[model samples]
Target: MHALFKHLRQVRDGGQRREYSRYLAQRMGPMIHALMLVGALAYLVAVIAGTLVRHSPLPLWLRLAPLPLLLLIAASTRRVRQPGLLSTLTLLCVALLEIGINLNGADDLHRQSVVLPGLLLPVASSVIWLGRWDFIAAMLLCALGPLPMLLSGNIDSALVFQYLVYMAIAIVLSTVLRAFMARTLFEQFRLERQLREQANTDGLTGLLVRNRFLELARSALAELHRQRQPACMLFVDADRFKQLNDQYGHAAGDAALVALAATLRRQTRAGDLIGRIGGEEFAMLLPGNSLEQGCRRAEQLRLSMHEIRRPDGPLTTSIGVACSQRCRDDIQTLLARADQAMRQAKNTGRDRVVCSPDDC
Candidate 1:
């Protein structure tokens, strides 16, 4: 039951449905086709047994009718791109074909019993693959399946009522099961997304964590190296962060850091990557930028930080700029150079930007 619900959830999830459809096309479709072929062969065997042993007068055409339908199902399964649609259509075809066969054998009590149970196949298929609307369609088709027997005057009122009760039970079960599976999948996806965000982002600042930022920076550096394009790293530090904590409190320092993070975000371009690398230290990666351009950007960030007002006073930052041309393609080497430049800014006086030694 658990395995079946998992399959249903895979088919139902909008994000995964397309891939699941392709999987159905490659794997499940062939399995279903094989099952249909086996059913067709079984029908042939049943016809032979009925003729030889029971002396049943079943028409050869009636027995052969399912073959063409089975072939159509195989063709449709192979051609359909959507799994839910394919399953719904296939189940409808199977239900209709079963109904027609049952109509042909309406006079035989044993055959009627065998064929009546086939109506549940669509309900089961719907539960396994169909979303809400498609499941409703499958249920409607299942409800209409026994209509031909009633119209033909082959089935009595009591038998009709019995079939209705059976269908009602199947519908309730399928609906409940599908709803449960959908809820389970939704919760699972939501939890996974939350966990991923928590893992990648800093808890307080809502910026990429040090490790995640480093990973992205390395990737950007590799791309820049391949393209032979220049990139820059800015290592920024709050100029008097320790003083703020000493004067006010840790809370005030934290608020100032959050504000600084927001200012950095506002100052950087869409392509630029920014993260808090340590207490009072932040890093930004500027792709396709030269040393001069990086210095200007860092100055802009430094000025922006100087404008941010706190309860104690205005906050300020020192920024160090290092270009890929001077530091090579290594992230650590580039950051180290940038860190040295940042220290130069801090030493000369706070709230300024300094370039790497080679650039200076």
Candidate 2:
């Protein structure tokens, strides 16, 4: 049983470093399932071995007598699905099995020897599956399992007692070790998740970075095409940004960018993809929006920007709107058209909205 518990921890730790919770769950979930299956299979094999040894001439049945109890313990574990509960139950079942084996075989020397190792199984189960209290429960059972041998003189009383005491120490030590390993694995998982978030997010706008933004946009584009769904993109560039940076310091320029990014975040819907793709340039991908709807949204953003009072007084944006079905399958091509329209808006005058001619 100690060996079985060790096997479980080995499998669980093997996949705990995955970066995403979804991927981590998917990876470890299978290994845990496989561990349970293997434990169950081992129990069945023990039962078969017990049955075959029952007819042996040398009384191997007594040596393998606790095998049925171990089988019962393994079978009980499969019934509980929740991790903490299952672990506790597995430990309790093993402890109870040890008590039963000890009581029934008080006078059989070989049976007593087999039951001593059975005591270790409970300790292992408690360390691997259950919490501290469960570990103590199994440890107490370990103490009890050997006392019958000491009482009946089936084994040297002092030697059996000494071995029992050593097993108790081992159980406590194993439980502590297991807990440390579990904590380390969880910490690694958290760090990996944080690293992934840092990689996929932009520092300036706190929005999805360019690569992640494009990946999401491409998927949304594919879905829109399949459903013939309405969708729009608003390509926004801060008007006179280079002049602003030159006249005011770059510090003031950064402040303006931050302010605009905050405004865009507040203005966009929860499902919209608002991303910073380049200096003073951002884009919004809005699903379920047509050209007319996009025009209204872009106008709202334009008015909002004009209303903002920065340290440099105010700043404005030039926006170009492009809706789905206005162009071919390429996202870059669609964005290029939107950029051209934005350039047109800038040429006509800044702080204005322009849409594709098909939209007009």
Candidate 3:
């Protein structure tokens, strides 16, 4: 039940829906092209067969007139980049094909013998559509496409009723096929997104993992450099993480870590980047912060300590601030400097903030 609700939420979320649509279109693009090509060729064959076999009273030019337009729509589908647009274009091609059929059988004399071709399009379209709008539109055209030919020709009323029954069955078949395919694609989309999220984030802290953090930090640093901005990196270490585990059990240590992470999230600006670098270690990148500002922020964090609770009543962190004046340095440089200062803070006495190279 929870999974079903999650799927529904994904379906209703505008951003998620857009993502799913793009994926669906990309995965099915080649198939859509192949099927459209085949539909065009099959349509051409049916038109020619109708003209030759029934000795259609309609001129050959008139019977074949819509063929070029039908192929044009089919060709246009190759360049269709949007999700719903392809469905519309493909349906237009189906419409044109139906037009050609009606033109060939307009003469009452030929309707009886030419009826089968019109019936085929309705059933064969089970896989061609991408959504409800296109499916409904295509089904309408395919279902009634043979009507004029049957009514105008010498066919009896009972045969006409049977043709309608055939179209009903085609509608059911197309609906079931489209629904099954759509559900499968949506489930695949949901599963892939879940895997991506799990891979990119730390399981316990809900923070970006090391490699993902580095990738985003690099991109952000490049942007800041382009704009001639300053940034700071803060390397935070739990001062007695191992001792906490030894004295109070791993559960207390894990609880303290979770609280520490929550504090970092609450204290940072929206633009700042935070990551769990590894066990008992975390890093933060603050865009547009100067050396003094970074040091001030680190001091505030040391004093408050995210309210981490332990058997000894509280826990503390050692923070190192590394700053760039003009955002000229890479993430690696800032990280190295910050790590050095954090080690200094740990050596000189824990629960304090230190700036690299005695700059501040």
Candidate 4:
């Protein structure tokens, strides 16, 4: 059906609709956790089989059964949740569960209490997921899960005491390590976000740079295509910029350019893309705009630039407007049309707006 295909398209692109990916990642963690439990069962069976068969070493196939599951879990964890936290907790739980059953199967002299150390790991994880105060409460429950076995005389008295000491040490160590790791992850994520924002934005005017402009334009075009809507591109060039730079000095020229860039930002909508493409040349991409609307917007920008004449010398700007057509799928074509129109505006006279050939 059309609806089914649309849903598939949304998932396949993995853009804008990222909740599905997040959900998939979250679910995969539990699935891998289930796989770990299966691995524990398989490992138990292999140990029992080897004991009964009186084999010095378990068969390679039996030993290999859990290896694949471990690798799968390790690989899958990175794609789902925070690897530092979720994977560590999963590994700790699996280790505890494995040690618990192994201890249960050991001979009287070799038996040791491992359940306490193992159970405390999930408590640490719960603490990480919740908070430190909540974890303290959760740790009590964790201690209780292993206490029944230790108090029932199934485990040796010395082993129980040793486990209690070891559990205490593990609780302190794991909590400290996990807390440090959690802070490190949070710091890294915050730094990454800041860097991404810096990269997308211009240093001087706080507008988007040319590189980011192209990215946003492409993304907008994709959305426009989906909605069957038209968009427009406007290219603006400061008239007699070279003359102004020569007469008033480059610093004054720079100030004028920055002022113009600020004007563009103020004039455009939240959805519009405004970028300084080159020295004294800027571009704007407006979605859901027709050729006439594009012309009016370009005229408005031109008038705003004319009104804000620099103190050293009056400044003027020329604008070229191009609207997307039935055959126009690429940004370059729209830009070329706008560029041609801008050149035409420059040729005719300064401080005027020019319409694209498509508009004419």
Estimate the overall C-alpha local distance difference test score of candidate 2: 0.66
134-199, model 1: which lDDT tens digit per residue? 567667766776566554644466766766777788777777777775556445555665798799
Query: Which ranges in model 3 have alpha carbons more than 4 Å from their true place?
Result: 1-10, 56-81, 108-123, 128-164, 223-234, 264-273, 285-305, 321-328, 337-360
The numbered model that scores best in lDDT is 3
Off by over 4 Å in 2: 1-21, 55-182, 325-328
Scored against the true structure, residue 301 in model 1 reaches a CA lDDT of 76
Clashing pairs in 2: none
The order by descending TM-score is 3, 2, 4, 1
**Ranking 1 against 2 by TM-score, winner:** 2
Cα lDDT for residue 233, candidate 2: 84
lDDT of 4 by residue, 1-360 (tens): 233223334334444234433333354456555555555555556456545654333344544444555555545554557434554555444545444433443332333424433444553454233233445544554554465555554647776777677767766665665466445434444466579779998877777888888888988977886887888899999988888889889888888888898889789886898887888888899999988899999998888886567755567888998988555467777877888899999999878999885642
Query: How high is the lDDT of residue 311 in model 2?
Result: 57
Candidate 1 global CA lDDT score = 0.72
What is the model-wide C-alpha lDDT for candidate 4? 0.65
In order, the Cα lDDT scores of the candidates are 0.72, 0.66, 0.79, 0.65
What is the lDDT for 239 in model 4? 89
Q: Write the per-residue lDDT of candidate 3 for residues 1-360, one digit (tens) a residue.
A: 234224445588788878887787778777777777887787678677766666657788777778787777778777675888877777777778777777866765634544566566766776656656677888888887777767774767887888788778778777777767777777888899889989998988888999999899999988888888878899999987888889889888888888888888988997999999979999999988888899999888887784767777777899999987653778898888999999999999988999875342
